[model samples]
Target: MSFEQFLFYFFSVVLVGAAVAMITVRNPVHAALFLVLAFFTSAAHWIMLEAEFLGILLVLVYVGAVMVLFLFVVMMLDINVARVREGFVRLLPVGLVVAVGMMVVMAMVVGARVFQVESPGRADGDYSNTKAIGELLYTEYVYPFEIAAVILLVAIIAAITLTLRRRPDSLYMDPAEQIKVQRKDRVRLIKMEAEKK
Candidate 1:
């Protein structure tokens, strides 16, 4: 077998193992780490497929940023691993069925490709994937893309609104009020007689 084939199989195995570990690991932090490993393996697979831009993006965005945030959040959370695991025994049969169903579906889809006509030629590399994606987003999919962005923006605003509170006892400053304040509002001058020693 070629080196590429070997690398592909190696990455695929690692990716699947990591994905399974991410779900089964008792420790939340360990689960997050496994998820990161899965992401990295998937990125490596993308690289093997000649999708260099997507591979780098997956590593940078998911592994570097998202997984780091996930690790921190999972570490900070007061999760009860035992309690979470309690349902696993009951859920295992259903989970296994779902997993097997997915595997079967994937196998069918992949296996059917042998009978389909293959498209010729590779996509031009002159334009980066990011540029092509952006072009497509802004041109063909602009409305849907903008709608999704608006939905995400609304969700962010909702989260902030839900979490934000006005605490009467807490000292806080308003930037707008600070910016509008005159020197007199913040400063005071006093005259006092000197104390005799």
Candidate 2:
């Protein structure tokens, strides 16, 4: 086997293992870490396929940014693992069925070569995947790209709206109240009567 094939097999094994561990691990933090490993291996696969831009993006966006945020949220939150696991056994069969169905569909898609395209000539040093993707995104797929951006924006807003809560016990300062404050209101001079020592 060629070195490239060996690297592909090694990464593929690691990717699958990481994905399984991500799902099966009891600790949410460990799961997130496993997901990071999975993302890294997937990026390696992309790089092997000569899609360097996508591989770098996958690492920077998912592993560096999203996974770090996920880890922080998981670590900071008070989660009851027992309560979360309570329904796992009950849902195992359903999950397995869905997983199997997905695998079958993926296998069929691969076997059929539904998306097979004519292999282009090997890339020259001047070829750039990022530029090509950017041109397509801004030109042919502009509308769809804009729509996806809007959808992501809405989702972010919705998440913030859902998680935001105000507690009466917590201290809060209203911007309007602060703006309305005057020097006289903030300071009051008190006159004291003289006392004998």
Residue ranges of candidate 2 with Cα displaced over 4 Å = 111-114, 165-167, 192-197
Question: Candidate 2 — what's its lDDT?
Answer: 0.93
RMSD of each: 3.7, 2.2
lDDT of each: 0.87, 0.93
- Looking at model 1, residue 162 earns an lDDT score of 95
lDDT of 1 by residue, 1-197 (tens): 99999999999999989999989888888888899889989999888866788999999999889888888888888898889989988999999999999999988987896657563346665756567668878999999999999999999999999989988998998999889999898899999999999
Error of 2 at 49 (Å): 1.0
Instruction: Give per-residue CA lDDT, model 2, range 1-197, as digits (tens).
Output: 99999999999999999999998898899999999999999999999988899999999999899999999999999999999889889999999999999999998998886468665456678877788789979999999999999999999999999988998798988999999999999999999999999
| TM-score of each predicted structure versus truth | 0.75, 0.88
Model 1: ten consecutive residues of lowest lDDT = 118-127
Q: Between which residue pairs do clashes occur in model 2? A: none
* Model 1 pairs whose backbones collide: none
